[model samples]
Target: MIFDEFDPKEDKIFRLIDNEGQVLNASLMPDLDDEIIVKAYKEMLFARVADEMAVSYQRQGRMYTYPPNMGQEAIAVAAGLVIRHEDWLVPVFRELGTWLAKGVSLKEIFLYYMGNEAGSNFKNAHHVLPFSIPIASQVQHAVGIGYSIKLKKIDEVAFTFVGDGGTSEGDFSEALNFAGVWQVPVVFTIQNNQYAISVPVRSQTKSINLAIKSYAFGIPGIKVDGNDFFAMFLAYKEALEYARAGNGSVLIEALTYRKGSHTTSDDPTKYRDKGEETEWAKADPIIRLKKYMDHKGIWKEDETALIEQYRTEVDKQFEEAEHFTPYQLEDVFQHTYVDMPDDLRRQKLEYEQFLTWKENRK
Candidate 1:
């Protein structure tokens, strides 16, 4: 197995394709058909397009603050390809590509960011948790789901994602500890995108790498070249199979670069230098995947036209979300409790009176 060969303790990163799309580890290359590879590339491209458009909408005040899943596309896309429909996806906000793959509509995503609670109700996306905002909290949820699946004797694996910095949170360790004890089928992915907001990976831990954390939990771990699509795919394929075979959870530290600002409200220039950004840009996931396809003589379609088509589709989704019904005042408090407390009811009434008075004045 790849995990047996590339131990996280040794700080060895499993890589199939290099930055220029040259296959470095031919033996580790996944046995994906050429058509599937092309489809994967297109999915990655569509994700990038949608991500860029979301950022643009945020800038224009059409949508609220949004996270950009720019350079980290391959990690999510690979997992999406490997994940079964029966599997559970517990995401921590940034896995846009996987969200798309799991049947989350762009409109639903936009609605959530627009501060509407209805967006959290992903009716079409089966076995997927809502986008988690708090760091590492979803890791615990994923473990809980894994435990339940084990009890039910179901053939389901729980896949959870967190940032490199999230590994420092108490919940991160707690979840892994129990998951190890129970031997639940869970795949914990750490998207080590170099920074958690402004803090770099070096500041997160003194350990050689994030994947080594799996050692404490007695789970197999591997460090992967997150920008290489094939590498990420192969890692997920192996991890999923191992977990499905009743071995326990696996930890994957996807070494990638956050090519954009942490969110629409934050500034990347303040913490990351241009030289470092330029260096990472060369290893951009989309570029590497496209290069690989081009080399394989499969990427001969009209690229510009395809991108334009994606942009239009993304815009249509955003428009639908923009024109969706406005968030109701009752939605804020009504879902909090089965029976609204007297104080909460009073507060809601007060807000209603205030709105009425303001409307009359207008």
Candidate 2:
């Protein structure tokens, strides 16, 4: 169950539940009660519905550009299920599920995609940081937060989510090295979805696995089945526990697939193979858990229907969220600093003047 104990060629990949939800290895399974399982299931269900709604909203011009985490629910939910609320979560763009799992409200997420400033206003509820879209930029923030936590003698750990493509960035490597050298309590999670835009994983790096890169930094690395909830949960739990126990940092590579377009603006059909999509779809995280639940007699058809009903309610919330006014053009300068400087003031004025002139020309 530990990183060093794992073999890269044989035991690097762990699976407690298969794609069909069959319990493949019960030994590694985490102790979970019915209530927790049901809660996890609900979170996954809501995440799927929310992701779909956001995609739909974007297609209809109700929201701004958004990323889709269609087939990666288990990665978020499992991590969410294990991490403490006091622990800080730094996420990349494709982490809607993690946010929700960390107790972020559905309304707030929808509002964020809808371009409302109020959506990013969950300052007091959770330690969830704002979503970052600039590849591996958030990794540094997570490292800084973890360092601060250590300095303050807080029992807090930082979990940062990045993609396989983000690993190519210099910031990713620097963050891992900094955390490893400083022995900061941080976990760097790389969700290897196989593609960074049109670039495939094969071209991303020649390493057999992303986890193996951790060896250079003197930190433990793990590669797990991202679709298998139990595997992800156990792996994350182990890493988080290690960090909390003052074991420095760990790198986790969750081997998952995108299973859909990169985002609402992307078109996978252009570069990806159709067969690969179908193959990954068969390993759907929700279906895998449902199969296991059914086998254990814990899942019922009627209960699934209720879950769907709840999803419908989530959709309704998105609809209601859309009614709120979008962020004003000037509001963009507000969050960057406490007060606008002379340079920003002049830029804002120029932007306002451009808008005014356009309107007059019309």
Candidate 3:
């Protein structure tokens, strides 16, 4: 299935890949080199398996609270591939897919979510920020980084990830305003995963589309099919190049559905309709990508085999992560600040005294 016509637009949603394994725009189709395509496929599979493992760990009480990035695989992998090593990545909490693409080990993420704060260091993760769980806070960080880069005149861009609901945040608006006036090289990629927690997009904004909001800030924006790997890859590449060229910022609205709950603490079934989920399931991005690869003869392995490989890698990583020293009460004191505050120092001392007293009583 091949459809090749035009590129993505601001007012209209851009989708180069379709549900039936069709390439909507053949001319604009990115070079799906076998090596890269296969790598992308395996990465998507790994993201999926790792997401599933995160859920499993949470249920078994081995992991801390985490937001699952299950169905958002394609967008992350595509964006990751296009982003250069020198550029910075400003991320919200739910960007496991992009993290993998940036070459961060799954072990790092597994450790972080498993309650080891050391994982936050991300040893080799150059130019990547710590995960910002607060809504839209990372947008400001990206804008700040964009400004710093411009001051230094570094030929680098910053890609920031946000969500549908995050757009409503005042911080996002401020970031966009500053980015526009400063003309920084930043790309704000919104993962419009339809629903934000229990709130649907329709309930949040009356705007025709999310990307078009960039127009107010004198920047270009496009809404692409988040699930289509081809569209995601090309769109990100285009945006990255545009920003790097000093043409100001770009906002990307990736239209897709969150196939699962917002986080381990959430239950989508309580709010979303089953029918809606089934509809989105039919358009599973990974499945479509796999089909395209199979038809092109680049990916010949059976689905079962591929998944088995994914499970083996993911499971092994999970096992290794378990050996990390467990999080302890003292960590609260240890990690609070580099130079411990006096009040916190007093609190830690009190805690230690209490522990000693309890031990003596025993």
Which structure among the candidates has the greatest TM-score? 1
Q: What's the distance in Å from true for residue 153, model 3?
A: 0.8
Clashing pairs in 2: none
- What's model 3's TM-score? 0.93
User: What are the lDDT figures for the candidates, one per model?
Assistant: 0.93, 0.85, 0.85
lDDT of 3 by residue, 136-167 (tens): 99999999999999999988999999999999
Model 1 poorest 10 in a row by lDDT: 19-28
Clashes of each: 0, 0, 6
TM-score of each: 0.98, 0.93, 0.93
Cα miss at 183, model 3 (Å)?
0.7
Q: List the candidate numbers ranked by TM-score, top first.
A: 1, 2, 3
lDDT of 1 at 129: 96
lDDT of 1 by residue, 85-126 (tens): 999999998898898889889889999989888789887999
Identify the runs in model 1 with alpha carbons over 4 angstroms from their true place.
Answer: none
> What RMSD does model 2 have?
2.0
The pairs that clash in candidate 1 are none
For candidate 1, the clash count comes to 0
